[model samples]
Target: MYARDVRERVDAGRWPDVAAVPEASTARTAITRRVLRHALGRLPLLVRFPDGTRLGLGGPLVDVHDPVAFHRRIGRSGLIGFGESYLAGEWDAPDLVAALTVLASRAAELVPAPLQRLRGLWAPRHPEAQRGTPDGARENIGAHYDLSNELFALFLDETLTYSSAVFRSLPASWERMAPAQRHKIDRLLDLARVGAGTRVLEIGTGWGELALRAAARGAHVTSLTLSAEQRTLALERVAEAGLADRVSVELCDYREATGTYDAVLSVEMIEAVGAEFWPAYFEAVDARLAPGGRAALQAITMPHDRLRASRDTFTWIQKYVFPGGLIPSTQAIESVTASRTSLRLTRRDGYGAHYAETLRLWRERFTDRAAHVGALGFDATFRRLWTFYLAYSEAGFRSGYLDVQQYLFTKDAARTDGAPRETATSTTARDTTTAAAEGETAP
Candidate 1:
């Protein structure tokens, strides 16, 4: 519809202000066409209109006015650039996700993007994850996760788990899922079966929520993370809670972790490890758990209908937020884990509502601390990046393209046969039910 309107206006000799011939100098015209073609030329995709006319322009050239910057974004960040550019007002799209969906499905056939990507292969990989050289694990973790602990705390429930919460019990605020988050922590602890004097291992222990909570319940906890900032804050948190003696935060890669534990739990961290490393991730978990130990793995899962993404969405996330992050379908995770471990998927729980609630809370928290965010030295453009990250994430959960899943895997539990226990209070949680259940089930 937008493209058709633009075309009709152009044909009537009433082009947009930016489209005027004088408005575009020789340099600008050459730059605009070159950058637009370069981004769009790679993908051979189309959008069909109601009248049966087709309108497609490869990659989007919506609000991007600076040709030089346009080239840099696609050439440097690929898909991430496209999104960041939009947030920075480099371009505009009427329906961001829809445009992205089209491009992502056709990304493999795109040639120019690969050629552009090759141009930077010789340049030292920017310390980004996914494509770049290892700047140590902490670099990217800090780049994204450690942006503002206070901001996270403001929105996240008291537990500060930062992953999807199991709303075994839904809360009235369905918007924030605060009550459900508390239930989620309880569920995770229950699955772990940590008792007084029990030893536990927590992988991707963001902010040390589970570790501290377990320690509070009298279990000895060892938490591992790649982020130095997280460690510093986590150590402080443990000390503040007087759990420093029982809860230890260490900086080590999950693959290199050692020591046996009675229980192992990982929350929302597997996606960052890349699909190639999942086998190793599970192997390390299995090796660290003692006989009869169990593990609870929580993560974001893609719906079955979301077969693919547009080039824009794919490149955006890969390049900017989580480099190397892959939200594989449920089958992918099940297949990978089942291939190696004797571990059985004792319980599989997905709550799209909880995630929508989580994102809503995060966005609100981030907005509340917008001034502090600005104080972090990020200019307006950078602020836009963060804003878009939060907004799009919420949109994703709301659209049902994403999900939050908790998969309980047991090593040698005697009671590995039982189903998830239901709670009377679970039915009260309703926020995520409407949005998540509706959006998540859709393509």
Candidate 2:
């Protein structure tokens, strides 16, 4: 990851407005310096340069290989350029996770207020090609999930679950985390009450893990995914497990899916569905759900204001990882369902710390399997990019800047007495769910 050595190969390509600005360089650098100084003053991050000069409050130290390059990039492109600087190897931290955690802690206030307001000049718009139309869904999903089955198998557990795993304990070793994945699927099945005679519709089936688990409970499952790679492998996995008779894997979009199901479940797929299409996504689920049916989903959520502020901004994760992705705030979900759909959120269990540990295990596995990953055709720069992505995500959850929740929703049918199924003003007398010292499995 030498400075600018792999610029062409690593950069996804610059946005149209991201160009050289030699005339404004000094003014831009001044603004960058001021904002960086203000943000660092709130965190213990010491940024050191080649001249033996260092700045910022002292804690985890960051070594800037080229201060001019680093500052120039951020000055030109704001936060997206900040991530690009990492790929360009302009700076590195002794403890990347700790350093990033500090930054994420002050994420909302990082840029100076004046410049933050002018973000549209720098922030890239979400690409139209990555929008969530049926056709775009297939293309966008394939962009990341279809990287290669062999590639994913290199690091993912045998379960091949791409979503966050609900762990039985924190600090779980890389080799011992499969049970947690299984436990996660089992709990989701329980939440949706998949039974012997139930028909289940699974949206975003990742290698058929959840569908298989549901079939084991004797439910008939129809699983849909837009990725051709996932469907091919998932269909094979279902057969390999001798449950092909019970599970149907289709390379189909959720919007076009028909037939009512007794239960509907989606795990962390909402993030990939662009926020603008959220109402339609939920409506599709509602449409395919039978009368008195239950639906459960696992979603990653951010704070409401942050979601609102950053919803339209192009992000590094959206560009290099999950294209067109956006994490919704819990309030946003609640509001969408309350106003646009007949569904009511009845139960929620948040286990975000489990996701941090899950990412740790994955990062360790991915790094340990670097040789295998290289054989799968990913370059060193690609490896660095993914490593940073996973670590950056872990730090968000570890710092409580992110959360994952399993929600149970039901059709809001009126009772025989003509009252709503559940009142908004209901008493808060229900038992609270708690995580173990290590995040616990939901029961």
Task: Give the winner by TM-score.
Answer: 2
lDDT (Cα atoms) of all candidates against the true structure: 0.60, 0.79
How many collisions between residues are there in candidate 2?
Answer: 0
Which runs of model 2 end up more than 4 angstroms from their true locations?
Answer: 1-24, 415-443
Residue 39 in candidate 1, Cα distance off native in Å: 16
User: Which ten contiguous residues of candidate 1 have the minimum total lDDT?
Assistant: 14-23
* Candidate 2 residue pairs that clash: none
- Give the Cα error of residue 406 in candidate 2, in Å: 0.4
- Give the C-alpha lDDT of model 1: 0.60
Please list the Cα RMSD from the true structure of every candidate, rounded to 1 decimal place. 10.5, 3.4
lDDT of 1 at 366: 68
Q: Give the per-residue lDDT of model 2 (tens digit) for 1-443.
A: 34545454453444222222123468879877777766766677888778887777788888888677778777766667777678767778868888888888788888767766877776778888889888888888999999999988888898998878776666677666778888888887877888897999999988889999999889999999988899999999899889988999988889889998999999999999999999888888878887678898989999998888788888888887898889998788877776667776767778888888888888878989988998888876778778889889998998888988887777655521222233332221121224422333333
Give the TM-scores of the predictions, in the order they appear.
Answer: 0.67, 0.91
Using lDDT as the measure, the top candidate is 2
